[model samples]
Target: MTAPASPGGGSVRPEVALAFAVVGYVALAIFGLGMTSLVTNQEVISVPGLGQLPGIVGMTLSTAAFAGGLWAAVRRPHPSFWGVPGAMLGAFLGYLVGIWGAAVIGGTDLAAATAAMGMLATSWFGLVVLAAALVCAWSGIALVRTRAGRPRWPWERDDE
Candidate 1:
């Protein structure tokens, strides 16, 4: 069957939404990694007094990346459910890239790199992905419901 037209009178295919979401997520992930590195390595890079809270900085960056990705996925006039999976997949890939690149840049050997990844596996990475997926899924559903003239929030009254 043919795809439905968007609210703007243009057709928005699922693939388009997924592609945009993936690109956005990947870019955000890179940005997050850069920010985290800058913050965590302030001493090495001579950015005086900036590496005070690496954990907080990393968490903030991750949250922003997830939110930005979800927003991009849902911003289309007509978004598809595929956007949810797209966001998750993009985030996972981005995390892999960011972590692997960081380890390599830090002069970590293969064993060290494997250890670092293992540490992340038992730490925040999985939690971040799960949270982002849930949020993205909810956001996508809300976008679709809103487009269908339904209220997304509990406080939104259906006057019709």
Candidate 2:
């Protein structure tokens, strides 16, 4: 069998990194919103530790998506430092889209939605973006440290 390709060489192209970051963040936002709505729209008994389930689920999904995006970006033959900035931009834009969508669905005008959500909600959204950025950065760094190839399983033979 041919040997695996090397991980380092050309850096990740800006356009490719941006595209991946945007797609990943948007998908994460959509999934998070859907999960939150599903959990909160239903009336169920309040469990002691389950009160924050929706928020937890949303955060978890977003974090996973951000990390996955970073991993994919860095795994490109030409991994670059641009992935971190791309991730931040994508996270901010995706959160904006989520806010706009929620406002539209709630039958509120943009101005009214902003007023309704108030400063605290806006701050929370910012926090979410920050968290996603950090996750993406961490993932990118980890990927950069590793070799590019399918990991060997314990049950698999050393020789391919």
Candidate 3:
């Protein structure tokens, strides 16, 4: 994979590290679950509606993974390094888990379920996340521009 850009290269490495960590975790979970299913000689771990549970942990890891990326991105002079892509991925994972859980609980057809998954995986969530990030970035730029280079602290910033 192409190495992602970074503020100082070190910061970017953390996101890569986090991605590797998540992959390791996913491997462990799959291995453990496979072993469990083997020992039980049943479909214990591969229950039809339970796939999303693993995804919850996956999304949690992804959120942390991309959050680190976001931090690194924000530290850059551009401040948009990997933020949009990272946040978009994080949001997509979150959406995946949410929609999967809903589908499982709602007993939706596989087509519908797959469609929902496709919506997130095919960059719908990314678009939404990009829009949100742009809004925040613009607001931040405006604030820094108008506030004499001093960031307005949340506690001190007015609600208007």
Candidate 4:
């Protein structure tokens, strides 16, 4: 639950971390699908049973960000920038999971369908996810913590 720190990030209060996690997932869900639709020429986001695709990209990205943020939050270094790599790695892994998941949900071949899953990476979706990760990563760091606790301005804290 604790990572070695070398210029790492501050230990975020649990509530703040939880809040950021919620906001990150929701933000990525919207942004991921928005970017996907924009690039794929879809008027609206795709669904699980849409055609041959599972339409789970948005969900995957959001989940990945959440997982990655958690990882970064708990990392020893706690470096603010750690979220970038953590979330990106999470996204890639999430994509693989999506491939298999789509195969299962769509009743298709996981092996054969793997090659066709390049649309997201090959398109603008990758960039969007990266942006989302950065946003997600900074969520807690931006609070300007004065002490090890919830995000409140210095003036808001009462002397104990």
Candidate 5:
């Protein structure tokens, strides 16, 4: 929504544009996966062991959805390759806290909730989160690109 090329914003910040774009991509990805699951009548996504905990799966999935976008918003603005990952990690910790609070409020057992966090951190789900973060981080970087240097269609390449 904030891309400089996006209309009506008057040169909006690159980071903000990246954030918006990343979020849009993430949403589309999830929607597509959901649709695919519906069409096939099968589970295309799973959380490994977290699914057994009461509300943990939902909370984790909900937080996992946007945490990377938060990281990407700050990341591609400038490639602070070092600092950005740390910030991304902080955002992840915050997500865990949010999950904890929400789960407890929702009356999920404290031990179960705690265990769920442990399982998530140690499981392949952690890699999934990291992969998601990387995807979100790189995607917005492309939006700021002014030109595509690769092969173009006939009309585009044969400009008058």
Candidate 6:
């Protein structure tokens, strides 16, 4: 059986959408981590042996990821674009560099490192992913509904 066609007569593949969603969420998390690194003084003491938050690298990577994702969605309007994946990859790397590296370079020990990892993996990542997924799903559904006469735009009344 054939799938339904998009408003543009192209089939909107679920896999593609899922990919975008995942990438977008990861990018969001990276962006968040970058913000923390840039604004907060998470790095108290930096030693030669420790790895500090490379602010420039974190900001650049995070921004690139978000911009790339948006660009992909804008340029291709299709699910299979490299920009989306690039955005995800870049942001994920940035998050690792920002949060994980910061905690490590701040003279953290084995238990602290483990705890930080756990917090980021469970609380931070989980919250960001859940939020992104909800937003994406809602927006996608709204788009589909709008095409199906759901009137997504602002309300307009008839002139008297």
Highest-scoring model, lDDT: 4
Q: Give the higher-TM-score candidate: 1 or 4.
A: 4
CA deviation > 4 Å runs, candidate 1: 1-72, 122-124, 144-160
Better of 3 and 5 by lDDT: 5
Please tell me which model should have the higher TM-score, number 1 or number 3.
1
Error of 3 at 73 (Å): 3.6
Residue ranges of candidate 5 with Cα displaced over 4 Å: 1-16, 19-21, 24-87, 145-153, 156-159
Q: Relative to the unseen true structure, what is the C-alpha lDDT of residue 13 in candidate 3, on a scale of 0 to 100? A: 39
How would you encode candidate 1's per-residue C-alpha lDDT over 3-102 as one tens digit per residue?
A: 4755533444434433443444444444544564565553221222223233233344444555555556566665555656655654554454455455
Query: What C-alpha lDDT do the candidate models reach, one value each?
Result: 0.47, 0.48, 0.45, 0.53, 0.47, 0.45
Clashing pairs in 1: none
The per-prediction tally of clashing pairs is: 0, 4, 0, 6, 0, 0
Model 3, residue pairs in steric clash: none
Report the alpha-carbon TM-score of model 6 versus the true structure.
Answer: 0.36
**Model 1 superposed RMSD (Cα):** 9.6
| Top-TM-score candidate index | 4
TM, every model = 0.45, 0.44, 0.34, 0.59, 0.51, 0.36
Cα lDDT, model 1, residue 111: 62
Off by over 4 Å in 4: 1-12, 39-53, 57-65, 75-80, 110-112, 141-160
- Which lDDT value does model 2 have at 36? 45
